[model samples]
Target: MALGLALPAAAQNVDGVVRPAWAPSGLPDRVVLSPGADAARQMAVAWRTDARQADAVAEIVEAIDGPAFESRARTVDGLSTDGVVRGGHGRYHTVRFTDLKPGAGYLYRVKGADGWSEWLSFRTAADEAAPFRILYFGDTQNSILSKGARTIRAGLMRTSPDVVVHAGDLTGRSHDWEWGEWTAAGGYGYAMVPQIPAAGNHEYSDDDDGRRRLGPLWAAQFALPENGAEGVVETSYYTDYQGVRFIVLDGTAGTSLDALDAQTRWLDRTLASSTARWNIVIQHQPIYTCARPNDTEALKAAWEPIYRARNVDMVLQGHDHCYSRITDGDGKASGEARRAQGAAQGPVYVVSVAGPKMYGLNDRALTQPDRVAADTQMYQTIDVEAGRLRYRAYTVSGVLYDAVDVVRAADGTKTLREPVESLPPLRLCDGDVGPDGAPCVGSAK
Candidate 1:
């Protein structure tokens, strides 16, 4: 069968698209793995199929030394919702894996009309504070099938990540074809490791009633943890994995729900209740912008104090199509993360993009960002250890862009350690053209 079937020209993307395959659903496409409320003992998988499948079941078994593993498998019938995604009618199936054994390998597959899907494997998080790694992406919102796929695939090849974090804008639109293209770009990698995605502006669209709605494909595409702040449960949620407490937030504007107040209280409580050694926040829009001249002023006014009072370690964000790392509002580059004695640590805010769309750096990026880049595709690898956390940013070509380490002491204080190393010369666009001499793929809006 073809990897992805093309849509008739009439159904071609309204805006330009790089990856443009649609799922017809004899077999499942867009298979993705996401962490459940508790990562150490539970996970979830979501996939799409044609309406012909009235029901679907997921079978999981512990992976063992031999092919007889199927004999001990357990089956769970997942919930399915049939809907129209931009003119395509299909069913989205999701199953929550309960009672999973921590730090153990498990194999699973989904059922379709013809047969079961090829076996896929995943490992649960360790039971306690232990070493692990997470891959963070800014936005794969455009040219996902072309330029974005390269960086996503490159990161997977470089490190075996235990969890993936997406700072929203997974697609330019909520159309199913674009969603399929996104899943195809990640391929099995999305199915193998758990992904935590925050909602982005592009993921929302006006409904037939003229009411704005969270991308129809969202809550359906990735089976995200539902344990979130009240009112925004579908888009704002949290997941505890290894020694990290990862909070997913919904900051998208003009959606049906008003998230400002409800999410603010939730943020305070969520951070106050954190028991994990590492606390990380993932939001699509930045409280501080690197590409846009205006900051997310509302977000900063409401949540910045909460983040600081809680000592949140990192803020992973997207929605600017540029890259930035700032430690505070002083406009001074965060020269080193490892601070000297008596210096308190603050959340190190990072904004980046992985998709083909690139935007020029703004004034804050020029003066405040410890690191900044333009017209480049990048990926970040975060290594989580019991006493320390290490971070590295690499361009799609695999050259290091930035590196930092946060060392945690027994008293819960963190010191910074920024590596001193030279990377490939920074690439900045020459007006509408890129440093490589090709027309810049980013819109520079």
Candidate 2:
């Protein structure tokens, strides 16, 4: 059976099986950078190679303009974990670089059985409260290399964010071929920009004993901070970058497993102890969903109170393969009306999609969402500063769809104001017709 989709640049289809082009041979592939607990002073990198490279070896140096910086490079040894997957057997290596100068630029490369990878460059976050940018995506779960790659490339070239946040569902069924397509889609962008990802339901599947388990490749592909709620530490963690504290939650586990209470308690404690000027929550399920018939009641009940009381500036989510920016939870009034009525602004809840799969909006889409879209692929760029956070959403082709700024006053109050430029009309299905006048792929829930 031929998979009716475009083959990834490095993949091949043979005998009804999709084979990974990056089946972890010599030469490091799928190189990804992740933020440490302390973004300024620490950084982590993870890569894969075949068993021939039993040891994890890498080299780092303070990068200089001249070509002789390699002379000052220092070798670093890391640990490796062996894993078996559909495509092949390989070892995943992870290394954390510490005791580095804050706000410093550095270069690093990994070793494989055959040779060394090309040097990759990255800069540590500044130690002080400063301005930075974050590029966000939702659910690159389907058609990753063909459709999703364009959005990633567009965001990278247009904004060049210091960090990237993924709101889960990175693959359709967590298959090795899907993961390979994902890594190929991002290419070297994954190697340079640090990623903070939340685990979606697709990342979890039931084991033989009926226990829900995270995907086998998740831990191997991305190195993330371990500071999180006790049981779900791998999926729930926090990383502070610049003036923002990004708290990631495992919504899948919280909703399905017996981890909701623990996560709620941890979220409250973490938020209470936060020292950053702005707080943002990254989770896979949305508090105010746009596609499903009803909201994710389980997670919303468990975590929404903490978000409200703790003053979480934004709640970024995926799972709903549509787009929505909801500021008023009650669905009582428009965001502009509430602002005009002097309403105390709460967290801005946003759900966006970057993949080909899409769902039609539900009944609440009529009035609840300040902005909503269907049958669309979207990406967002957020510029965070001490006084304001500027958010802009764009299409895969780089058309601006939505823009807003959350202005923080001296007394810590926030106001959501739109940019002076007008936005395009909402992208929604016109009865049986899609926004583009094609056969509607966005099916109703």
Give the top-scoring candidate (TM-score).
2
Model 2 is weakest, by summed lDDT over 10 consecutive residues, at: 1-10
Q: For residues 274-326, what per-residue lDDT tens digits would candidate 2 score against the true structure?
A: 99999999999999999998899998888988888999999999999999999
lDDT of 2 at 371: 87
**CA-only RMSD, every prediction:** 3.7, 3.8
Model 1 misplaced stretches (Cα beyond 4 Å): 1-21, 85-87, 208-210, 253-257, 333-342, 430-433, 440-445
**Residues 1-445 of candidate 1: C-alpha lDDT, one tens digit per residue:** 0122222222345553423356455687778999987898999999877788768689999999788888899999989888464344578889999998999999999877666788888999988989988999989988777668877888777777888899999989887667766887788888888998998988888789876777778878888888888877888889999889999888874124567888889888988999989999999889888888788888889888999899899999999998787876666444332344356768889998998888887766777877788888889989998887898898888889888887889999877776787766666776788878998665545
Worst 10 residues of 1 by lDDT: 1-10
Give TM-scores for every candidate, taking all chains together and pairing residue i with residue i.
Answer: 0.92, 0.95
Roughly what TM-score does model 1 have, to 2 decimal places?
Answer: 0.92
**For model 2, what is the error of residue 319's alpha carbon versus the real structure, in angstroms, after optimal superposition?**
0.2
lDDT of each: 0.81, 0.86
